[model samples]
Target: MGKASLLTSERRNRSARGTQVRRERVRSAWLFLSPLLVGLLVVAGWPLLRTLWFSFTDANLTQLDQAQWIGVENYLYYQDGAFYGVLADPDWWNSVYNTLFFTVITVSLEVVVGVIVALILNANFKGRVWVRAAILIPWAIPTVVSAQMWLWMFNDQFGIINYLLMGVGIISEPLAWTASSSLSMWAVIIVDVWKATPFVALLVLAAMQMLPSDCYEAAKVDGIHPMRVFFRVTLPLITPALLVAIIFRVLDALRVFDLVYVLTSNSSSTMTMSVYARQQLVEFQDVGYGSAASTILFVVISLIAVVYLYLGRRQLGISS
Candidate 1:
């Protein structure tokens, strides 16, 4: 009886020691992470809260100090038997449509092309090192610089794009790629795909590299076709990486301003939500209205991100 009691006490003591060790580790982790948490609060949280606050007031760029609280007037105000503000504005809806269209198209194209490029890059070939380095050149270039370069290439007169198209008899003359409303969005999309595809490719390539090689070897010994192997074996393994890439690209594309603004300026055809917010904030000097738009944009992105992650988790069979 004494020996049994002693064993129970020892076990209890060991469990207490383990629990104390875990507590210390958790405390140390939080202590190390406190600086980063503080920085994020100061940098992002504060600004977001300020923006939300500003959205409820009648603020302007020049008279920000004298701004008055107006409640939801900037979002939707009822006056004189009518509705108004950013919510009722046709231009705002147009910008929302433009933003969604760009996000969907760009992300789809980037993912498809990126996966193809990643597959090619993963294969063993001569001069593979140089090819891998060269593929990243477009992504490495500054967005502003790339946008400006493409602007010139898209010029109606004496541009290389037109030159090559005419050379191939694709068009009779130089087309106004960035000037026409019909073509401006396409031009912006092209430049974005060129610049961003490399980033997705790199991510997918890294994921592919980490895959176990024995599966491929075993499939090869079984005389499986390459396409079949890719569909059945390779694709399922790399889906998580693809999901991450898509989420990142979707987030980035939704908030796109620089590429569109630089490429198409204030053209309504290519004006994203960010561009619309900038126009209201900077050009029109309506801080409250702009802040309202920005808040909506933030909410929309957050909701979409949440929905996407939830769907992704279900697809991956991850328990909540």
Candidate 2:
């Protein structure tokens, strides 16, 4: 009886100790997470709340402290014909169209070119490391610097681009690539594609390198054509990474300002939503209206993010 009682006590003590250890682990995890939680709430949460509050009030920069409660007046102003003319104005629509056109064309070209470049870079070649580094040069350069370089190249009379094209007889006369509204969007697109394609290539190349060599070997042994192998084996496997890269590029393109601003000086043809918002806020000194527009942009971007997440999950499930 005494031995049995001692055994029972020992078992109970061990179980209690195990529970205590688990409790300690939980407490430690929470302790470590507490600081991060606080920081996120302070940095991100507060600003978002403030922006939401500002969207509702007539908060001008000069009279920030005296911002009157305008309720939904600011939002209504954006909906009305006079104040919201920026939305439906022909110039505004032209900017919107140009922005969309640029985004679509540039992104499509970048994806195709980037994929090809990535494939070529993945192959074994002499001086491959040097070539890869050279490819990243444009992407590594600062956006402003890249814009300036391209701007100089697009200068009609003194530009190397025009000179080269003329030397090759591509054009009979010097063309104003940036001066003409019609050509400015394409010129900016060309510059953007040049600067951004390398980034996409690097990302896809990284994904390609991570793929299993054995899969390629198996495909080769099975007498699969290179094109078929790519579509059947390679594409499906690297799709997640590709999707991630595309999402990042899309977000970057949507918020584009500096390149367009520096290159085009907020030209009617090149002004994006962000550029428009900034112009209203700074140039026009219509803070209330700008805030409302910004709020709308935020909502649109949020919706896009949600759609991306949903689609990503679906794609992940299908791939799995």
Top of the candidates by lDDT: 1
| Residue ranges of candidate 1 with Cα displaced over 4 Å | 1-31, 318-320
lDDT of model number 1: 0.95
Backbone clashes for every candidate come to 0, 0
lDDT tens string, model 2, 98-160? 666777888888988999999999999999999998988999899999999999999999999
Output the lDDT of residue 245, model 1.
Answer: 99
TM-score of 2: 0.86
Write candidate 1's Cα lDDT for 1-320 as tens digits.
99999888878789888899899999999999999999999999998998898899989999988888899999998899999999999999999999999999999999999999999999999999999999989999999999999988888997899999999999997899998999999999999999999999999999999999999999999999999999998998999999999999999999999999999999999999999999999999999999999999999999999999999989888622
Error of 2 at 166 (Å): 0.8
- Full-model lDDT for every candidate: 0.95, 0.82
TM-score between candidate 1 and the true structure: 0.90
- lDDT, candidate 2, equals 0.82
